[model samples]
Target: MTLPPELSPEHWITHVFSAKAARQGGVIRRNLRDIERYVGRSAFEDELKRRGYHAVENAGQLIIFCNQEPIRLIL
Candidate 1:
């Protein structure tokens, strides 16, 4: 589908798209993120610690303490 020309990444997240192509009734997210922050292949370090997700960065992509093990990864 063609989005508005002015549409941005943040705008896309704010778009309340129906989960027609996904599972169950649907899922909606009150996105509290700024897309610009995650662009350019940046690593997701802080989230790893906050969310308990695994960190598997190849190199210097990320640097954080997960549970206690030093990890590096790009979300």
Candidate 2:
């Protein structure tokens, strides 16, 4: 996933969960704009929602709070 142009590369991308999987230490990853064009987290979140996933964003990371289990996501 790409990052928002407004946020610099130095920023840290962390997944934020609401009621579920709140203690998974919050998955952290690099927003490598080089690998992919900087797409906003909002856009990704919307896409996930469009596919029937419950998600939200905290800072730069988009966290999909799946009901059954946390999918140790790779960024």
Q: Which one is best on lDDT? A: 2
Consecutive 10-residue window with the lowest summed lDDT within model 1:
22-31
Return the clash pairs for model 1, or none: 57-72, 57-73
List all candidate RMSDs to the true structure.
10.3, 11.2
**For residues 1-75, could you state the per-residue lDDT of candidate 2 as single tens digits?**
444666542252232233234444333233333313443555545544654555545565444544433455467
Winner by TM-score: 2
| lDDT of each residue in 33-69, candidate 1, tens digit only | 3223432223223433454534333333332222443
lDDT for each candidate structure: 0.35, 0.42
The clash numbers for all candidates, in the given order, read 2, 0
Candidate 2 residue pairs in backbone clash: none
